[model samples]
Target: MSSKPSRCVVLFTLLAVAGCTSSPGKDFFTETIDSLHAKTSPLRAGYSGPAAVTSASNAAQRFNGAQYQGTGQFVSSGAPVTKVTGDGSGKFELNLVNAPIADAAKAVLGDALHLNYIVDPRVQGTVTLQTSQPVSQDALVDILQSALAVNAAGITSRGGTYQIVPLSEIMASTPPVSVPSTSPSGPGVKVQVLQLQFIAADEMKTILEPITRQGSVLRVDSTRNIITVAGSDSDLNAIREAVSVFDVDWMRGMSVALHPLKTSKPEAVAAELDSIFGTKEGPGAKLIQFIPNDRLNSVLVITSRPAYLARAATWINKLDRLAETNESQLFVYQIQNRPAKELASVLSSVLGTTVKTEGQSGGSNVSPDQTPIAMQSDGVTPAPLTGPSPSLPQQDNEAPAHATVVADVENNALLIQTTARDYQRIEQILTKVDVLPTQVMLEAVIAEVTLNDDLKYGLRWFFENGGTKVSVTDVAKAAAAATLPGFNWSYATDNIQVTLSALSKITDVNVISAPTIMALNNQKAILQVGDQVPILTQQSQDTGNGSAPIINSVQMKDTGVILTVTPRINNAGRVMLDIQQEVSNVTKTDSSDIDSPTIQQRKIQTRVLVNDGESLALGGLIQQNNSVDRSQVPILGDIPIFGNAFKQKNDTIRRTELIIFIRPHVVRDINEAREVTDEFRGKISLQTPIQKRRGGTKLQQDLKRLAY
Candidate 1:
């Protein structure tokens, strides 16, 4: 052999050895195909042939990790690769004649590339391509995708393998609920399972499906009564806790029965229950229902939880206790101020209860013969009493009355028996009656005024009717006569020293003037009188004569009094008045002159308690008497004394008296006060009598006017 041929042969042998080592054999390809086919084997039954074909292509691409760049043969009859070309422009040429897609991919990519087929077992399609052009792996994928579009085919790579799937299936699958985690769970983090009993499979899916994205798996079985969850410790714990609320049917409820007490009515109890657990406003109507029994003797409470039923039962018990308290007790009232009969009348009218008076006449009782016997249940009439029937029992017919008042008129007491609730109402009514109209007490003073004869005639007081002033020209003769001892010149000088004391029933102060109306609630009066009086005091002064009287200082005398009165009203609508009265008087005594005149004062005071409209009269005061004398001569003395001849002697006596009156009225309200004051407000004015027209008779006027 030649050396050149031997070198070429050795080089060829090295290249063949490199090719055999670098490129996989048919067995490697077969193994790759088997792996891909196994991965996509499940999809073949569910997907079309084209879909399986696309999956197999993806499987090969994923395993090889290389993209097809040039012409690739698919489904042609010839060697796996008839032509191959490579250039730096990313361009290649290859011929695949009558070969499957797997071989075509291997030829196009490189001699070292391996192709795996994962097509459907039933598929008959093949790849045949002869081209010289620059093409990308994606372009080849696009061509395959177009062919598989009719069958709704898709591909997915996982675990270094491609799986075939229908396009519709790919589109229909939902995105993961949560993103998968890249880092592994820490130590002590273990997968846990949560089982749901009451929740439906679909609902559990919706609630826990989100954990799938966080590397958790939720396995639900509709046929089973439980749901299984697998996840990390923390995630599984969270899901288990959240799903517990939904594990039990909260809509399912329990029922409680109740019996009505004696004091409580079924309808009333039902109303209260409704208020607490409303049909529409509280906790969803379907969760609570109040169903009354047919006889209304019991009530059924339907509630979602036992707690609700317990709360309702507590309220019902409280209401029943209150009602029972009101019904079981008795009330009694002892009235001291009001008369028994009157109180009984008030009780009957206000409370609508019958009242009985002690020592009252009894009604006639029916004889046993007149009374009919009740028939027995066996249709036999009961026999009458054998002996004469005693007088009917005192309380025989009182059973039907709610209350009975035993009125003792003599002792003025009322013993009552009634319910406690009724007593409250009775008390209120009594308060109003106690404030009925009250009367006022009245007190008055009457006095007779009299003047001493010494002052009346000796002083020769002048009157307004006619002045009687004596001339002093005759004073000298009178003075000479008065100077004689034991001469009777003064008229009754003993009476001048006498002082008439006033009766002890006069008051100087007055409160609440007469003709005033006051309410019965407030009835008290205060009176005060502060009157000023001038008095002349006798004083010794230096005069011409020793110890002679002269004008001295003038003094003021306090002749005023004060009175206060308070009235007590009784239940009889009458008033008892407590009165205190005082009076002061200053009287002037006869003296030599005005400056030497003596003054004396008298005070009258009294206290009396009397009934309404009662009168208090005061008397025994000073009196005054005056007389005038006149004389006339007969006609024979008609000369200078003729003026007195026509007159006859005559004496006239005059008397004067003082009297005071007081009256009071008690009113209940403003309207009553107004009516008392306006009692005579309405008056008819006096009118002139109408005169009748007499110019014509009735017949004459009728005849004249009747002319057509």
Candidate 2:
């Protein structure tokens, strides 16, 4: 009994120590109770005014924080919360925190402007907004509407009252949408009519339906191909911009269009397209067709889908370019400034084909054996063969691979049966060759100068001056210098008239001819300023028995100054002239047999290169030592010293030199050619009046002399 009592006492002592160690602290237990109360307690209602507080006895019955509640209530601290505030100037301020959207809008519109409003029961959402400054009434309404829109609600003014409704019921509650004569204002619903050009109205409506608002309406008028949308201004504008992108030619579907060709033929292009996008049959095959309108030079495209049309249009644009290559086409190219036959020959040579004239015998590539023969009139006679028999293999040659070029003389066009690539090359060559040739105006002056003591050597010596470098070259020397042959002497000068004028001052200088003529490049021009002399070629012998011997023959020959010049202009504007000039005259009639006239002729034929507007002088045709006799009396002229007083005897020597000056001017354009023509006209007009005045004076002198 004693041992058991001792063990019980020890166990009791240990249990008391363990209890003391596990006990909770006073501060921690208090914090735990406060936290549990704060978490589980109901929310306290905010005090607004005296009405929010119950009667004093009722508040005393309700549990207070620490003691009995008093009658006065505490107002919240810091800035006072105002759902909406206005400055009476159409500007308002709002401080809403999770407030109902309807109450928020009513506070802004009704409390500020005293406006009536109706809020739908379905329009339920809280808006949180806190403005730092005042905003316009329209801006405040816009903010409210945007907040409403985010919650699938919208607001519209109807009958002078704001109606806040769900987006699904906005159109039903508001007035019917109409096309506004002007732009709609203030975030209200609007109506717009969009006319589609390429896409159908119903098709565009399908595209816009997904992005359209729930309250908006998209109506299509198929007959007019127009879509009418009733929505907000923003939505209408977005639809308009989208329609512009989708309603284009490239976006067309199941349509027909015409594309005109500029450089390529429509038939050939259509054929090429047929080879590319060929016919297809079955489901999902592209429905496309190309038809060529040859008369209008246009192609018609028919397609069933926009994608196929866009693909075909891209190819059409590529193939219809200027000078696009193609297969064979029969094209009639109008010959502008060249002969069709000559141009055809040039084209044939360049393209390696045979030329065919309009009415030539073998104009076609068809062989004689291939040509169909006509039946004979009689039944018994067999049809005649158009060519040799088949036994002759040499005559039965194959037709040429390249078609011949046919020349249409009547129209002055070439009928080319060739590919577009070859025709493009041919066109380039034709543009170069078939143009107006350059024209050159050649002016020549032929003068005969009676040499005096001052000009003893020649005109060359007279023309040479200190300021000018005159190169006097004889025929042999000119040939050695690569100058023109057949000219006796050549010299270059700036002005040939200056030398002639100076020579005329000392001696007689007679201008035989001054001729000016215009000739095309590589064409000949002739100028004759003298008479045609009849020459007796044969003399009639007195026949022993004849009545009057018939005069045999007389031939007419051109005499005096005659010039023939052929000018060739190079690309560098230099002229190569092949000139043949002749100065011939009947010196005297011979008293010998046939009484033929003796002719003195001086001719020069040569080729020379001269720059445009430069002058070339050709000379050295001289007659020297010509003696003239004068006698006062026949017997006294031969007598010695005393006879000199009785009769004067004089022998004069005459010397004459012929000089020709040539100058060529190249006329580049019509303006320059007109200027040259006007200058020549002025010169002729001046000379005509001068000649007339001289003739009148001479006539008056002759009349006065006759009267005397």
Candidate 3:
């Protein structure tokens, strides 16, 4: 009876202990909390806080070479919705459907519950907006919707496909802008490039960065009318040098309308306009300066007349959807101006579509109106899509044009994605006038927009279509991104390094820098994770033989990169990966040497994960156990007086990080200490008895040292 009772009590005690056990999860949680609080991690991972967005005060913010505040909503096809004039707030939930844009939105936003802010300053007063510390996708969408409601207009997509609200419409309802009574001196060295190729804010930062740091160069106004000149004569020269690289003609000598800022500072717009226009290089004086009286450009008159070509130029914006294919939007400036009849005939003859003379279809309404041919097209009628104005105000007249001047005059611009091959075939039919070119020209602007790892949207002379690519049949082999889990391998034209982002917030990654890793030319990749993605990596070869690299693949690893990738194509792409790590080891003072605590040598290990993309954008960078952090090198711990010096003959490994690229060929880094330690342990085990050697292993030793 006593033995039975004892056994029962022991079993009950064992069960209770197991039920209330605290395992590695809790242990790790406690350890991590204590270590992080104590500044424990040798290489404290770098992280960025959520980005805050607000309207530009006077500095005037520009996006992609266009003046923009935030996204807009589509108004009714032909309905006068309510407009808000005073300071107001509301929401605009972007509805998604079976479309690529929807997929992109999901891929970017994920399931985050809130978004920060999307301020659209349509009113005269300033916009009040800031970023929340814990930003959520819901918050981002909410902010976007709130901006859309500035005008408080009801939006109704024609077919619920896709639509963007017009900034003009929202601003039109805004109260007049109130100018301050007291004005500064002359034009305060502020200028806005009225026209330029699409560029990012970061690029502008790169251009303007040099002057921002100098103490001698003071900004007259942080809001607007920024003047950047050296306080001293000598410093002025240095400022000029720093800005030189950014002054290259991005438009390749195309007419760029530059408006000197209107200010009371030293220089004034009115004072400069006359002298500038008088000069041969001035926008108004130069024949290259493109201005429109009709706010449109006719592509049909390129060879004959090169004047204000806003309407024709507007067509180029239709190619924005092709960015994924590694090609940029097409830009075709006018070389000559031709007769409207001639322009109409050329497009009608080439694209196999009929040209009309009136705004209404199949109508022959004629009037004695002789507005020089303004709009041009490739005879392709765009679908009824809603978006922002495709062309800029190159023309003086802000008045709307009669539809007859355009070939495909629709309310909104319709961008279609296509392939280079099909584009080649279409080019064969058009650029040659009667027939497409048998051989592509060396300088031809062959536009290719990448949609994903596979598939490209391109210009088929005048048609837009989605290009197909090599699909992955085998589901077994795929690449896993730390940022993107559902990532598969897709072949692309150029490597695109995508950091999983939501509402403009990068959710993960230690640090993100432009061109973080290194690879041979043409090394970039793409990845999509979870239900938001259609396929992981899709691949297609570039048809052009321009010799310049067409595709590359670069990917960020989740854990110390250790994944492998196999390109599905033959030889059309390349991939590579790079990693830099810093490691440190600390030791306390020995009893014999009480004066100074001896520190071990800190180690820096750079582990680069190499890949081969073979010219396609679809590839992956895998890291083996050979991982190294950027700061894994030697360092003295933050000591009071005698700190930072590595102890002689002592080794310290602090932290490690990894970077990977996929394409052509890649080199990897492996550590020898692990191997040597294993070898040393094996020798010790052979010498000592089994009981004494017990469970000591090199892997165990390395891990133990890694723990505090």
Candidate 4:
């Protein structure tokens, strides 16, 4: 490539790092707790409130120990800990052989993570673990504990510090049972309970097909198991009254087998799903692991019948195509692989609902009369399902024609990955999605994409496809009526979903689009009061503040964040000629305050809203959150004021956000701003400078600005 093109490429590369292209900044805890290295900023500010404290209760609630503990130790100091024991009550206890080491660990675990030593369920006496200081092990304290403290993967402990609730107590609490394992029995619509187990929140879905065998079908009273339609009773038989039904053939069975619940209770959650939805005329549903954070609380869905999974897959294929953009800049990002136990976390984030999972493999079934946790196989169990779990089907050379939603419920995840060739289908579905009654004039598109840290090019297209007309009623109706092959009409009306765009466009960032739909799962509070509720996207900002992007480097001349030096390549050496300077600029922000005559002029612009609700003052700069709003603002950057003696000017974008890029040294006092522009991935080049102060031989006595 020519030097000119190369320079453009270089500048563009640098801009990607320093632009307004990232998801909304992360919450304080997520960054602080998940950061790998220990940081010491005593005055670092973040949120602290009842909600934040309560929001953190998830980890403690799941284990349900009297006192949950997380331990940390210095790797350099091998501290020994012992004397672990549990009182009759449920408090954990442990002693650290070294106080300093224990204190260091205490610092790492903090209030949320304190190591609690408890009696192991399987082991008798006590065991002490001296763990290294807690840090991000895949972004979790538990994961960190496992990697450094417990010394195990995929294993959780119910600490030794508290009193143990005997397994015998949990069983004795159940009612007495009489039936012993029978060797042989007479066949009469033979039913057998082989095994049952508790499943996590996500695995709690069942797909049952109504029995089609002409003579094999049985009808029973709705309230009791008394078979009224035995094979012999064709007349006046209670057989036809079967309120609930099932087909062993249509069940695809689960993909990853779930372990039986730790409890011996017989009534597994899986059986209930089938009976409730498997009943005649019942709407079959699946437990989608929408929230993957808390396993204790999860959501259950009355989903489009199992038949709709096929159609949903086809539609997803089309969406995957729309997400495909320039290969030069890919934004597909996967931060962490959550576990099945984290299903509730994913569900919570996606659907904003409470959900949980519970089940086990090869466990006996639970009965209606018995406790919900009862374990007895006397009742005949539904034959386990069989077939291939849902996946992208094989095709020849062309792209796929379907969409598939893959949920790792056990792992608490739902990944929507689709191939190319479904863009037209996606567009068609989007255009027709009038799912709700009152239309929500979308003011923002929150395009979310995962960009490589290299920041060359990540996601570009904001939520341009959003902010268009979408109807909730249509989407729900379609979802309700949707079936396989023609899943088109099914979900377009009801499910009303948007595809994952590598760089999905957010066209409008108006303030009125409140309680906007996210994940097609936001079931409540659709429209916001336009006047009372200001849209985050609609908030205005000035070029002086909002415009200081993460540049390769920049200098302030009483204006916005403009490139102080342009990229140029040396023809002789082919090396990039960059000069990263720390300039001290002192200039008046407003035209009225004409101070510091050394500072020249400030450049600004006013753009009219060509498209309705567009900007006239705040050029291309987003005034609100970047995540929830789409990219509609156009960025027309700045130029330095020459001669360094003129007055600073105003951008005159009326009633919009105003930004002023003060010299770096000027804003070292503002912690937040400093954090915003630290080491913004730009390089500074140096050539030659000579000054002989202490009688030393110097090459030349001047500075040189190289020419391209």
Candidate 5:
């Protein structure tokens, strides 16, 4: 009895210690031990009563197990409608239908976790869920928030309480947090600050606004080039995608460019474009700056993005067009490769106005009633005038009916005051007219041919048989017969040198003159190869005061080969030549008048067309001479019969022909012109003396160096 009492006292002391350390809530350790005891009671039923009792007593004493089995399940008869029940672990069971979202959130967070919450007035929704298996505490909270999101309401944690608000107002309620990465945090609405790398934040806001949710908020920090967005995860994803596409390296740089205006003034165009696409000085400012250069007629554009620059350029191009109204504008056009006075005259005619040069007596005049002559579709001839008289003066304040052109000789430009439409027409005409004129090189060879019996017809027949296409006009043939058979003939051949070489072998060819000259299109070139002889035209007898006989007048006559040629080159590489050739010489001296001589001349005047690099031959000037020669021995020819033998008499007849060959080459560029010069120089070098040739070579070398 004493031992039993000691054990009881020890056991009572241990129980008091255990009760002192136990938690105030339901005891999980005692409940779990009772559940084990009830489960194993059936397994120990088959043993004898005392043995079982003894085994159970020993187990209870060693392992601290309970003696009696206890119920393993707890049951509640009438629970609250929105009460939360869960196992001791993190798992919980939920079975609620059409429960208020606020109460459901309270049951999960407030009741289960002992946390605080406040629902906004706009947060109104219901949640219905029935789960057979228990969910973890975190999953239950997630489900509650999902149900709230479906009704356009969201919950965010602030301080220690869960604040529930309308989805539209979630961003306003939550404090913004910076997210370095582009991806979103999670679902529902959250405020995230994003720092942009390339694109302007304001521009990105515009791009994201359309795709953003109804309750989302987008703000820009221009100074920092960042964007703060409050949106759902999907909305943030869309913003990220758009930012990725637009905010690239190609869109980052700022560029400046000058765009020259073609018809309109730079100031007017720049002003118009600025009004259309210009923006203020901030993020996404497109037309940062526009500077109009009146001297250059160009607009300078400054922009921060290439795309905006392209857009601005497009608008500028559209606005920089000629104004259709009759508003006068002043424009200066610099004449290139043409005389300003000449260009002004042409433009004046096109504008139906009379423009006078510097020294002229007329003020600038425009016709009020007249319309400018429209150019034909072929761009050459002017259409017939269809309007009223062109002499009508313009009113004081009204725009000039016809454009006025003033030639600025010092600047070599034309100052035109006209309507934009008229100016456009004038500019087109200037573009076509004020250009370098085409040049032609004319080469001529004048030769005198002593005709043999076989060549009595003329040199034309000789050239025709030598594979040359020769044609002569009927008028040329008639003129040839009137003046010792002088005529003009044109022939086409590939090589003029080959023809000349072949002609030299046939007869005694004496080249009187060979000249190569360059002339502008439709200009005249003259070549004279001989002397000017003075003829006594008038004479007076000696005066009564014993003065020598006064010569009243003397005339100069061109003797020998004289040629005047005018070449007109066409676009098809063909030249039309108007040629006047004359070969004149003193045939005899008058015995009665020593000072006067007989002059024989053959002239041919005609026009012929020949291909470029081809030759034109003028011939049919034939002259015949008959002479008698007598020879006798000095002394032995005294006897009558012997005199006949000693004396010799001969009769001779000489026939000669004059031939002129003219070849034209159209020089289109500097290289062709240089080639012609070199060819001419080569010909000169052949005829020059050795010393002169050396000097010419040195001069050519210097010219070559200068050209280079």
Candidate 6:
């Protein structure tokens, strides 16, 4: 029994410990106290503090999650026949229907609600509504909302009361309210009266009234030009902002007129305007629709912002100025052989502006009120009296018939329009394009190849029958006597000699100088005469001294010929040609010891002027080719053994002549060029056709017999 009692005591102790463990301690309680103190301290010091609560009191400011600033009844579609009643708890109710919505609502809810209703005497429709069973107040309100027009009336409750009235009546009867001038916050409805001097009061009312709700009242006094509005501070501030955009002197209606210089049709101008301003979509919380004007090219800027009108005016004025300049000055020109489309492109490229063209449409050709003439039959031509005719009457300051004219391009002509000052410049450019190209005649003769006089096998036989070795010195001495002064030597030889008399010997090779020729269509061009003419080489002594060994230096010389010419055209389409020619004979000498090349040149030059289709001949260019051959006499020449007997030598010389011919023709027009081409074609045709078969003529048969 004692043991059982001890077990019971242990169980009791465990229960106590468990209970103690489950409960909070003094530290946790102290923390809670500290937090309470921190949160309450501000409230005790007379500040509202953060919106929270330890207890609810009339003086304590607390915020509930589901709450609103003011009390209000709800309505939709300009009616409140269905009541909207709600408590702080989430419960609501609705009542009677089948009557004027605003009147029934006012009777049930009283003045607590703000109602805005405008009575249209012309409107006679009645709203009928019924419910089969009880429903939430929201359902009843929704039913009423579906039956009435929102623009006519509405119901709103504030300050713990409900009211209903016509939208227009409420807007007019509500007391003026105030809103903070700078801050758009705080409690209560605020009213503001703004007197607009520039914007019409009616217009401001139209813009503001539609956007305000039942809680907001907007009134306009046309005579005083003032706007009176009342609403929640936020709603009132919004209305004020909207008014600010259009409350300006320019907003009344700004118009700008532009008269383009070219008098474009109204439709065309309208298209241009549409291209610029474009479409925009609004008024008060809605899109401003853009409507295009079909009657005029002018755009009606139906916007409340002045800047848009100003910007559009600036663009239109700029376009107008351009049109003015385009029309103020005019020029017309006729060009042949150029199409209108092609000419327009050329003008656009050259002038950097748009150019338009029309198909060869002939312009006006009316004679100004001409006198009547009697008709004559029989196709008889009237004969003029063989005497001076009387002078006709002349009108004062009247321009001649030819003075004023329009474009006519039926004869393959281009009609051009430009400023008066640019007319001459454009004319010159067209003339250059249309004028016939100048024909240049050229004549040339390529003379013989450069001379190479060295031995074919580097061995020179002095005599054919010597049959014995000859010293190179003796052979060099003999060749030196016959060598021309300008001939080059391959091997350097001591005691070399050249005869001055050889230089004076006139060869068949013609020498010439470049021509100083000039030609001009209108003005003379810079001449290149005598610029590249070859110069004759002067004689010089060798720089090497007679010593142990000597090195010969090489020299450079100019070779070949140059010719220059110019043609001048006269009024009669005749070309006078000036010509110059230069001829050169050059020789180059090189030795193994020389570091640089040697050259020498001899020149003959001449100049003359000739007419078109004339020929100039230069006859003095002649070249020579020389060669020597050796053979044994008959059988002795062919025998390998003792074959050196009776050797013989033969020398040969060949000469060539070079000549040049030139001709030129001046063409004035397309017809002239075509005629020349046709004549040449006729000649070709004559040589192409086969003739009828026949026996050969006497001259042809004789030539054939000689060939056989």
Residue pairs with clashing backbones, model 5: 485-620
**Candidate closer to the true structure by lDDT (higher is better), 4 or 5:** 5
Consecutive 10-residue window with the lowest summed lDDT within model 5: 692-701
Candidate order by lDDT, decreasing, is 2, 5, 1, 6, 3, 4
User: For each candidate, C-alpha RMSD in Å?
Assistant: 28.4, 23.6, 59.0, 55.8, 21.2, 33.6
**TM-score between model 6 and native:** 0.29
TM values, all candidates: 0.26, 0.42, 0.12, 0.13, 0.40, 0.29
* Residues 1-708 of candidate 6: C-alpha lDDT, one tens digit per residue: 334445445444544444455456543334433433454434466665554535444324332212113335455544446554545353344444556654444423342223333333433345555555554444444444444434354333344332333444544544334434543332223467777868898888878777866444456788988887775445566787888887877734544334332322335444565555553211221111123344443434444555565665665566555553232233455555454345444443333333222322342232222111111113433221111212212212211111112224344344433333233444555554544445443322222212223212111221123322321122222332234332211111121011101111222222122122223333233322222323234334445654444433433433455554556666565555443434444333345433333332322233233455444333233456577988777877787767766777789875533333333445456675576556434533344443222112112211111111
Ranked candidates, highest TM-score first: 2, 5, 6, 1, 4, 3
**Model 6: worst 10 consecutive residues (lDDT sum):** 495-504
Query: For model 1, how does the per-residue alpha-carbon lDDT over 377-412 read when each residue is reduced to its tens digit?
Result: 133332221112233112121121234445555455
Across residues 235-259, which tens digit of lDDT does each residue of candidate 4 receive?
A: 1122233222222222344222222
Candidate 1 vs 6: which has more lDDT: 1
lDDT of 2 by residue, 1-708 (tens): 334445445444543444454446543334433433554445459855344756655443333222223446467443544668777777888787777877787776677657788888888888876788999876676677667888887776677777778777766764445544455565555566666888888878787778766535457899989887775655666777778877887634467878877667887778777777864544434567888998887888887765766777778888877444443566678988777767666655544344433345745453322211111222333211112323212311222223335677667777766556555555665666677778999877787778888778766566554322334333333552354333456765566666555556677777667677898888789998788877889767678857876766889888878899999999899888888889888866756666567778888777877789777777777876556665566777557886776674467888888778888989877898998887666545343232211111123221211111
Q: Number of the top candidate by lDDT?
A: 2
Q: Tell me the lDDT of model 4 at 478.
A: 34
Q: Which candidate leads the pack in TM-score?
A: 2
- CA lDDT for candidate 5: 0.65
List model 3 lDDT by residue over 53-148, tens digit each. 534331222111112132454554432322112112332233232223223223223323221222223322212233423333434444433433
The global C-alpha lDDT for each of the candidates, from Candidate 1 onward, is 0.42, 0.65, 0.28, 0.25, 0.65, 0.40
Cα error, residue 424 of model 6, in Å, equals 5.2
